[model samples]
Target: MVSIKEGNSPDTETLILEAARKVFIRKGYDGARMQEIADEAGINKALLHYYFRSKEKLFDQIFLAAFKDFWPSIKSELEQGDGSVKCLIRAGVNAYTDMLMKTPYLPAFVVSEINRSPERMEGLLQASGVDAAFVMAVVQRGIDRGEVLPMDPRSLLINMLGLVLFPFISRPVLSRLFFDSEEAFMSFVGQRRQEVYAFMCRAVLHSSAL
Candidate 1:
């Protein structure tokens, strides 16, 4: 007879986190339940608590990881390279969309969590070291180089993220209200991935006279 391991073990923490991620994405933070998470993890309530003391604690861990994963690509892209603003914007847009596509639920998960607890997000943002201030440094350099027109870098950053992320975050409503089909919505998003970069490049890089 082959020996088999029984019940939940230390490794079950990883299983719990995975299950938590799925549940959180599907249900959002306010709607998720400990019992549901335990069921999803194929474990009992006691084991769930053994891995994560509470739902809030579990969410905190998951949210921090998600935030870290989401922000770094844009940060690195902005911080690196000696290219023009057009090049930087295009690269950042592509990188941001690629990251979002790979983690489809991430935007909704983040927005839901932040809406639930803005203070918590503020603290996390402060600690993350990738805020408007850092992005502005990159944008200011472009302005100083005369590579881009004068504008509030933070406003531009916000607009860039909003354009790239809002469609995905509002996909269900957008699909139903406008596209009327998943395929149409997906196609639109695919097109926007390139269009967004082009729009940003044109808006930021071109002279006002043009």
Candidate 2:
């Protein structure tokens, strides 16, 4: 693939990153080889090493970026939004699904890597910079105002995340049973941008309104 450059050629780091994302997505972390990444970037292994001393480091860079896609900087996602409980849930589903729509393997990659190293969870969550208290406060306000159900904010977040990610993670199986082909499965997901938000309405919005 050609490196997307404006007037000048893409820098070596950008090429390496883009190439690494493709290989990591296609091969997963375990299966991706540094040499393969080098070839993909049209660079020699020595130069690849010069840029990223090791595969783990390169994967770390990509993994952190991918994690951001799943859960963007908490400040940006949490602070800039409507802050209503239902709107937050709806936005999360939309952001996650939209992100996965572009990179279908991201959720699977994240799940695999996290499971491969459960010890990293604490540091990863810490690195997220998301204040649980702040998010709960948002949920609490919704509850107080009767805009949200009396549920733990964390549980609601998990369920909302699952609703968005599971479809992408299960795409292959879903294709076999629910849809006739990968194309059809993705088509359904494309249509789900609004459908998933509407589903969130039932969970947080009053049933009488529907």
TM-score to native of every candidate shown: 0.86, 0.84
- lDDT score for candidate 1 against the true structure: 0.78
| Residue 34 of model 2, lDDT score | 87
Q: What C-alpha lDDT values do all the predictions have? A: 0.78, 0.77
Candidate 2: tens digits of C-alpha lDDT, residues 158-196 = 777778889888778888999888898888988887887
Candidate 1's C-alpha runs over 4 A off are: 1-10, 75-80, 208-210
Q: List where candidate 2 sits over 4 angstroms from the true fold.
A: 1-10, 73-82, 208-210
What is residue 63's positional error in candidate 2, in angstroms? Answer: 1.1
TM-score of model 2 vs. true structure: 0.84
